[model samples]
Target: MFHTESDVVFVKGLTVEAVIGVYAWERAITQPLLIDIALETDISRAAISDNVNDALNYKAVCDDVSAWCQAIKAQLLEHLAGQIADKLLAKYSCHKITLSVAKPTASSKRIRLGCRSRVMQRSSKISQL
Candidate 1:
């Protein structure tokens, strides 16, 4: 049985190139996107048993997100972020997830603008991490 306690695993500053944009010129080529993800899970069993199966494999998650992002074209950051959340929620063992997708060069040369999306499965009650 899975534990009820919520533990968060995060990956930050993961930059990937994707075909995401609103303008025609922007969509002509790939742009850099910075993705941050937090997944809420119960890692007590993994911590105790020191088994990889008991915990989320962040590398696999990163690879999946990177591949998916590269393959999709989105006109809005919200849509892209939401897709990532949905994919992870369906594929991983986490009850809740928080994702931030940023286009570091979207608005201005120095300004980073994007969206954040969070999703939780209703079947599982998520605890504060």
Candidate 2:
């Protein structure tokens, strides 16, 4: 599909509060996890209808991600990001997703650090559902 644009929707700079870190001081407080996600979806119906119901509702996706992020007590950014990717992939049935999470308030110099993960919906899992 060279030069062909895929129907992709994205959510960027979605800041969510979660307890994410490996340090003792970090465990005591909530930190903001900056998230960016791009999902590959079919938006043909939405394009024709101009209806949100026919589209991939991003507000709902944000809410879902927020809820999931806030549920953690203490964790690493890598695991947290992976969990987020898994939840979104299953709920939205997207064929592919690219997710990144960054902890901006991590260091004294504010050196933002985190990980990026990409996950695909397996054919077997989709069939099972």
Candidate 3:
């Protein structure tokens, strides 16, 4: 596999509220969500040019994620994570990305839920005859 160095872009502790779980009680109310995302891309151009356009605008990414989450409610954390990963891949052109979503305190007798997910993407090149 090939690897590329990104500009170390990340979004930490982005809090949001969503309904996610597998139990009846879990679905009854919304819960706080913490999201962390890391993107891998060559940011040299942006660094050299000193232009925001040349870099991956993290705010845009966050807005997109928030909107998508608000629009589509998921019953499981796995599904929610997958949705975010897929959306980022489709919306952004990057070599790799990792996303994690956590419920903080979902293990209580009242809550009883916890989930996290991570994904990575790689670039591929093929020889044309």
Candidate 4:
């Protein structure tokens, strides 16, 4: 039972360089990683007002993601993806979130390694504290 006005706002292909992974070589050097984020929320207020403030602050989301990514070192893309989703849920008012993390194929030894994570929750039920 979802409303038609419920939409997912997103920012994709946000590339940043960070020290990530378990390997010593990986820790010594930074690598370019890309992130895609989707946040689901009711956009009726924003639609009516046509105000950026009334909508999800996408620039703020990107800033938070960048800061979080730089602050932590994760051994796996799955962990990073989960962290991103959790941060979004905790920081913003949203019904659901989906995050994807991708690293270049040439950089990692693992075959086609990437991660995607999704979280769904009711906004009314979420506690602000």
Candidate 5:
């Protein structure tokens, strides 16, 4: 585990279309969603080497999540957020991951309906759930 202050790699304002929500109208059509993700990692090696392989691959993560969101039908923001968190935590070498999912069309202009989830890789615990 890295005891030093960790670095953060972020993907912001990612837009994707998905089937989500409980209302009849919502279920009938695919709606646009805005997603943000921050992944914690030790960037020391990547920074020094200037190597793409040594760093957290933010593009691949974004692409994977975008594709996944488009493929699944989720009823709530929580479930969608959880699925994204689970996928990233399983696929990446991140120490911690923060994911936010927003349904722009579901809410009024004044508000946004969404959910955020954070998953951490802990040394003391083997089970993530």
Candidate 6:
């Protein structure tokens, strides 16, 4: 039977500098964004095997996230968040993903995109590593 119980792997307070926003001034400069991510996956194999190869490689995820953030010229937090979710879900072996994105200098505290329950759909769109 498929395992029903799962574990959460998370990364918090990862700061990414990206050119995000729609305004003229906002588009002109890169801003620092705080990102938090949660991934749901079964790690029983890794736990039993005691091998890094058996586990989810968080370093790779962080590296890819940082690279995508830098490479994407997305204008909105929501859009970027969705793109990130879709990309990670497609690339990683996670069942679900949750993300929180915040502009430290923006008027509001944060913008949260809804959780993605499915992977690789690519309709639209981490971590403190």
| lDDT (CA) per prediction | 0.88, 0.83, 0.74, 0.80, 0.85, 0.77
How far in Å is the alpha carbon of 69 misplaced in model 3?
A: 1.7
What are the per-residue Cα lDDT tens digits for candidate 2 across 1-129? 232666789999999988777788878888888999999887778888899888998999999999998885547887777778888888995778899999898767968788998888545664465
Segments in model 5 whose C-alpha atoms lie over 4 Å from true places = 1-3, 121-129
lDDT-best of 2 and 5: 5
Off by over 4 Å in 1: 1-5, 122-129
- What TM-score does model 3 achieve against the real structure? 0.78
- RMSD, candidate 6, Å: 6.0
Which lDDT tens digits does candidate 6 get at residues 1-129?
Answer: 356676888988888888988899998999888888888888888888899999999888888888888788788877788778878888899878887777777766465432233332444312321
Worst 10 residues of 2 by lDDT: 120-129
Of models 2 and 6, which has the larger TM-score?
2
- Against the true structure, what is each candidate's TM-score? 0.87, 0.85, 0.78, 0.83, 0.86, 0.80
Candidate 6 segments whose C-alpha is farther than 4 A from its true place: 1-4, 108-129
The clash count of every prediction, one per candidate, is 0, 0, 1, 0, 0, 4
lDDT, residue 93, model 3: 72
Model 4 lDDT at residue 33: 83
User: 1-129, model 5: which lDDT tens digit per residue?
Assistant: 344687899999999988999888888999999999999978888888899989887789989998989777888898888878878888988889999999988757768878898888534443355
Q: Mind giving the per-residue lDDT tens digits that candidate 4 earns over 87-115?
A: 88889988889888888743456654577
Give the distance in Å from residue 35's predicted Cα in candidate 4 to where it truly belongs: 0.6
- Candidate 1 all-Cα RMSD: 5.6
| lDDT at residue 59 of model 6 (Cα atoms) | 86
